[model samples]
Each structure stands twice: as structure tokens, then as C-alpha cells.
Target: MSTKTLGIALLGVGPGSEPHLQSLATLADSVDLRWALARSNPDKARAAVPPSTRVTADLQEILADPLVEAVIVATPAYTHLEIAAAALAAGKHTLVEKPLDVTLARAEELVGRATAHGVHLGVVLQHRFRPGAQRLKQLLDSGALGAVQSAVLQVPWWRSQEGYYAKAGRGTLARDGGGVLLTQAIHAIDLFRSLVRVRAVVASQIATTAIHTMETEDFASALLTLGNGAPGVLVATTAMYPGRAEVLELVCRHATATLEGGTLRVQYHDGRSEAVEGEAKSGSGDSIMDFSPDAHIALHRDFFGAVAEGRPPTVTGEEALATHRLIEQIVRQGKERAA
Candidate 1:
């Protein structure tokens, strides 16, 4: 694994690209940093990667390079399909940032293109790669927790009004697609859904809290139905003061599991206990990219391995659609209630 290296390019070098950059930094040996397309800050992008890597402003140049076997599209949500379409059409493996795109339709199209071109497509939903998350997933899959009776997923986070949401197109439908759920809690939503399959949104409420004025909701609360016909609740908000870690609590027949931040603790009814601490950070506060790069690194490794083996990545385009569809359902239900 250490000696196997794949030619990779980073497109849309921006603040959002930091995690991916950090992952590539640790994966230097596993990947050849072929190109960094700055398009905006060429000098900054050049300084961020190794001097051996080429810095370019043109997408065509990166697409034309046969050695660039994979392209990581770290661009804005709306630009995802356009950029990723080119890469996939060129027969290069592509990994796009989360939420897939501004719209689920666009995301579906992007995934369709990858399939049409016979290329690997993955989304940057890194939560399932976290150690704690992995443990919980295994427990549920092995039936060690028995059947899930109930669950609660909460993301009580904070994003300063002046410094965060006020940024250009920060919480707008045109830019980020939606608010906290899409931009911030998507990771948490994806992670929880992977561990506990959420079957439906029973009821929901969405709102733009007094904490900030934005086009999208800064808070959302919903009642959910789990796959086992169990009940669950989802509460996500970026208006909380002095942010804290997100949490997911599950009450299973044999055991109960509590996941907060990067830690997971499970208590079996028989007095046995289990815990797996994760290093992945929770960007629940002001800075969205404040988490550790462990999950990101894992995603990179899995993606590269999947490409080499001609297998679908763990969080493939189709797998990611589950989250996107779930988010859309939450938003639509919430808004309809308001209307």
C-alpha cells in the first residue's frame, strides 16, 4: 500500500479544500500530486503542495494529462457537476465534496455520467470512516445491539452571524443548497444514517433563527421513522451559543450506544461495555474544517484502493444519494409545515 501511488489532481483550491489537502499531505506516498488547479489563488495553491506538483489555471490541462488518473473536485456545490462531469467523461476517477451538488437531480446526473464513462465516483462523506462511527456500524450490522428501538440525532452547533453566515452565498439555496443540514450537519446525518437506517421523515420544522439572517434555515427539527419501524428524531441547528459536539443516541434491545464528537460508548444490558475513541474532529464551532484528517485520509485510501481494484468506493455516488435524498426530504417537509 505504501509503494502504490496514483496520479491525482486537486481542482478548486480554496478554504474548503483544506481537509483534502491535509489528507493528500499525509498520503503523499500513496498519491502523485500531479496538478493543483488554483483558478483563483495560484500562488497560494502552489505554496500548499509540493514543488514537484504543477500549478495550473486551466481545467483542460489537467484533464488532458493521461497520468492524472483521478481528480478531486473541491469546488463550490453548484460547480460540482460541471467539473466532475469533465473528469468522469475523461475516464478519470472523481471524488466530489459532500451534498453531491446544489440539487439532487444534478448529483444524479453526475453519477450517471461516471457510470456511462465507466469511472469510479465517490462523495466526500467522511464520517463513516471515523473509528467510533465504524465501531457503531459494525455493532449494528452484527446484531450485537439487537434491534434498534429508538434513536436521536442532534447537531447543536454554532456559526457566528457576522463572521460566518454573512459571507457571500454562505447559507443560500443558490450557493450552499441549504443551511446547517446541508453545509454542516450533512456529515452527521450521513454517519447516523449509515449506522441506523432512517426510513422516513414523519414530521419536520425548518426555520431561520434570530441568530442570523440567511436565505436557508439555520435550524431544523424532525421526527423520523427508522427502518425497523422504530422512532427517531433529528435536531440540527447552527444557532446554538458556544458550540458543542454533535451526538447520536441509540436504544437497542441488547445495548445502548451514545456517540458524541469522536467518541462512542456502548453499554449492554448485561453489564458489558464497549468504547472506541475516534480522532476525527467535530467542526461544530466557528470553523467548519476544524476536524482531524483521519477520516479524510481513510477516504482517500479507500478511494484509491477502489480505483485500483475496479470496485466501488465505500461511499460511492449511489451510496451518497441516500444522504442527499434524506436531506431533501427533511427540508421539503420542514418548509411545507412552515407554509
Candidate 2:
């Protein structure tokens, strides 16, 4: 006797196609990929997936397909709300990729709809499962780091000129939401807020200093006063050389902890520091595209488990909405400063 597999419909198969395909393939036993939706390029969708899998431009086709119990919305940022809402309304579970939605209001609507329908809704915040990051979170949870005073996030990720130009909506406010902070650094920022128990973000400021081409900022920094009265700094840029490392360092009363390149380093006030090793996906060239299909797989596994056990997924839509509100506030502050 075996458990029945959940059927899934993939809602986008363009530039960001392979990772989701691989993730589905890895969990094939648990997931039946019923359809691949390509509203933009149906030919590209056909080429991206195996001939055995079905292809359709209509999301309703997937919803009507009795086999599809869930939908993975991999469309562009702007269309996430529209597609995800449809999937949820059709009585299917949903796993939407990061940012949840470009705006706080849309995210809230999605959460409310999912709750009303009694369906599981998850957001892809896979970075939390990284071994080193998980260990650091554990330490902080145990109060081993003591009272966290402040933290800094340095994510100087690099993207090639061609990469930015390749997509019409790569660095635009209309499509991509914002630049590095919203796209790249939100993962780290979300983690920072989670670890610090950031109940209230008192203030935020943003600016575009480095990348002149993009409508949004390539370089920006912000100072935040957390609800618990802890201060923090977030600095991110897509303009850097030789690639850049994503680092998060937390200063506490008893010890200071830093995580970078899969290593967790902690310096205690007693003149002792310890290092715990980990591994992150690295590219052959000097590009900061450290994405892993395994991360997406892990995310799927959790979603399926939650559906079967009737529990909430690790990154629920409601929790992600909180992060979206924070980002909206930051962007509003940035716009004010520019005005």
C-alpha cells in the first residue's frame, strides 16, 4: 500500500524554468506534473518540458484537470497575485515563489483567500533550510547568542550586463518590483527579521547610487529600529566585482555570530571563537547566481508533507506578507527621499 501522489501544474516555463523542472523531477514519486503553462511562449514551454508532460496556455485548463491538486506559480513577479489567486480559488493548494506579491495589499488578499478556502499556501523562502543558516537560527533561538543588539547584511551580488538586458522586466519597478533589495537581499532580510523578532520597523531609507541603468536602486542601505528596540543595518548592491559574498553578522551581549559562504563563525566575549563548516552552491565563473535545484526540491517536499499532514508549510503566505509590508515601507521611504 502506498500513498497517492499529488498532481501539480507549473504556471511558467521561461528563463526560470529548469530549477522548478528539476525540483518536480526530484519529487516525482510525490508529485505528478500534470501541465506546464506558457502564456508567453508556448513553444519554449514545449521545449522546456518532456513530451510526456502536457502543455497549456490556459491556467483554467490546469484547474479543471481533476488530477492537479496543487499549482506552482513561477510567473513573473507582477502576475503572481493573479495566477495564485486563480489557483487557490479553484480549490488547489499553492506554492508561490518569493516576494509573495509585489505589494502588501495583494499579498494580504492572497492570504485571506487561502485561509477562507482552507487550502495550504506556501512561499519559497528556501534559504532558511541551508544547514549553516539553520544552525545559526538554532543558536539564536536557544539564547546562546544572548540579547541581539544589532546586525549587518552585506549582499554585493553581481549580475552581468547581458543578463540585465536579456529580460525586459529584470530591473524595473513595474515588473521586477525593485532591484537588489527586493530581489536578492529579501531572503537575508527576511531571515534577519525572523531571528531578531522584528515586530516593528520604525524607519527605512533607500537610494540608487551605483547602477544608473535600472529604474530601481542597485545600491541602497537602511537603518532599522526593531520592535524589541534592537538596531540593525541592511546594505545591498548589485554593482560589485569578482562577485560578492552574502554575509549576516549578529552582535549580542555574550557573543557575535557571522555566517558567510556556508560557514558559521561565532566570537564569544570569553576570547573564544568557533567555526562550523557548511557548503553553498558555487558557479564556475564569477557570478553570484548561487541557486540550487535541491533548495526548490526541499521546498516542495515540505509543501507536500504539510498538505498530507494538514499543517502549515514552512513559509506560509501570511508570514511572507509580513516581509512584503516591510519592503513596501522601505520603498515608500525611498520614494519620499527621492521626492
Candidate 3:
């Protein structure tokens, strides 16, 4: 293990920034959060962190700092590419919030730039770190679950206009790129894809329901095929009132596993079964900060180790882009069918 502590900074101090802030606190030994950039509320951001840390509105200042070795892009989806590219260009090991960015092309550009700069890039798809998800992944890899013959991904979270979508650029295509799929379901989608490769989106539907006045879809549903020639159905919507824990179910040849929150319930056909739990509080409800910070802590720890040891993080930008590719196809194909 690399013993050197990483010097890190956070770009943007807003909704998505809190989880990382919480994580950095837990990872103070391996990571040092030396700076923050809060364009809207510098005072609030400053008060949240240690008095020794600097909070500013200037991106250039953070970029020019020799001590700031890495930056977490907690900015909005549309702003990810611009901010992360600058950090990568400055040779900082960059980690951006999920969905990579607002679009696939831009996500590709950002990942390519990181590669060109010879720096590390990671995405905050923390669901992959959940204990249950990790165990399920290990089982699949070891063939304990057999082949995934079918799967189901559901993120039936809830958010009201006042609680979520009403914010400026909250559900706007210009800022968020899309609604439920991009903003909320991306984590589940990333984890789902990790568990089983989605060969294609066989069919899909994307629409904005009467729940909000957003410019993007609040509901998205799709039928997908797995790489193993199986099938899966994915339904993600924030319109589900009084949201429940998201679920990922994979029906393998030998057994079926249901992952809800941090708990994984597995049942084998031969009368064997088990339920394992891990850190599982995700903002599956009205507030986006409803989740636990342990996953973020784990993510940051791995990222710092990756940076120190000259290796890829647990969820690399390139690996994240694959999720974006599937998301783009879902949105595109769904919109086409809607048209």
C-alpha cells in the first residue's frame, strides 16, 4: 500500500459535494482536502470544512496550485467535462460525479483527455462499492450464480417539484441532460451493467410525467438484452411517490439474487439461501443526500490509493463511459419511440 497522503480539492460546493465532504473527513489520513471552489456560497462551504482549508470561487487558482494533487468535480452534470478537463490538463488525478457529463460525446472527450494527460480519472458510481453488490459480483465471477439468464433493474425513487425538480436546472436538459435516468438512475444502471453487460436496449420509453414541469423525462423504461443472450427490463422513475429502496434482481441459471438497498438475498434452486448486508443508505427518496457516506469514503480511499500506486481506480472514467453509452442509447431509443 502507498503510504503517502493525497492532496485533494473539491470543485463546486453544492448538493453533490456533501457526500464527498463527508467521505474526505473519513479519509483524512489517506487524503487531504486542502481547497474548495464554491461559486454560489463560499461562506457556507468554508464553514463546513476545517478552518485551515481554503474555499474560493476561482477555478484557475485551484488549478494552479502545486499542492492540490487531485480534484473531485462535484459540479453539475453539464459542467463536468469543462471542470474535469481543466483538472486533468493540470495533471491532477480527477474524479467526477456520475453520468460522466451531460452527453456521451463530451464524456468521451473528458475520458480521452485524461488518458492524453496521463492522469487518473474516476467516477462516483458508489453503488458498486456496496457490500451486497460486491458479494453478488464475486459470486457471478466465481460462477456460483451461474450465467445471468435474465435481470431486472428498478429505481423507483421519489422527488417532488419543491423537494427536487424545482431547483434551477434541476431537471432541465440544458443542465442535467435528462431527468430520472441521468440524475437518479445512473448509479443503478452503472451497477447493473457491471453485474451483466447490456448488449442492447431492445425497447424503451422516455417521458416527463405530470409530476413536474421539468424539460426532461421524469420516467424511463426499457427492455434490454444481456451479453449472455438473456433479457432484462429496467424501470427508473422519480415519480414513484414516497420512494422505496432501489432493486437489482438477476435470475441466473443456478440461483436468483435480489439486491435491495445494502441487502442481497440469494436463493439457490438446490435449497441454499443467504442474505448479506452492507452500507446501503442511498438517497432513494425526496432528498438527494439521503444516502450514507461510507461508499464515498471507500471510493475516495481507493482513488487515493490508485493515484499513489499508479493504477486505475475502482470505477475509472473509461469504465464509467460505458454506462453513459448505454444511457445515451436508452435516451435516444426511448425518445425515438416516443416521437
Model 3 segments more than 4 A misplaced:
none
Cα misplacement distance, residue 293 of candidate 1 (Å): 0.6
Tens-digit lDDT track of model 2 for 94-182 = 99877777666777888999999889999877767666777888888898889888887777666655666345777786787777777
- Residue pairs that clash (backbone atoms under 3 angstroms), model 3: none
Between prediction 2 and prediction 3, which has the larger lDDT?
A: 3
Please count the clashing residue pairs in each candidate, in the order shown: 0, 0, 0
Worst 10 residues of 1 by lDDT: 278-287
In the predicted model 1, the residue pairs found to clash are none
| Candidates 1 and 2, the one with greater TM-score | 1
Clashes of 3: 0
lDDT digits (tens) for residues 1-339 of candidate 1? 336689999998898889898899898878998998888879888888889989999999999999999999998998999999989888889999988999889978988998899899999998888888888999999999999999999999989988898789999989898898889999999988887788899999999988899999899998999988999999999999888899999999999999998899999999999999875358876677887888899999999989888789999999888888999999998888888
Shift of residue 283 alpha carbon in model 2, Å: 9.2
Where model 2 places Cα greater than 4 Å from the true spot, the runs are: 1-3, 270-274, 280-290
Ranking by lDDT: 1, 3, 2
Q: In model 1, where do residues sit more than 4 Å from their true spots? A: none
Model 3 per-residue lDDT tens digits across residues 72-163: 99998999998998899999999999878887889999999998999999999998988888899999999999999899989988889997
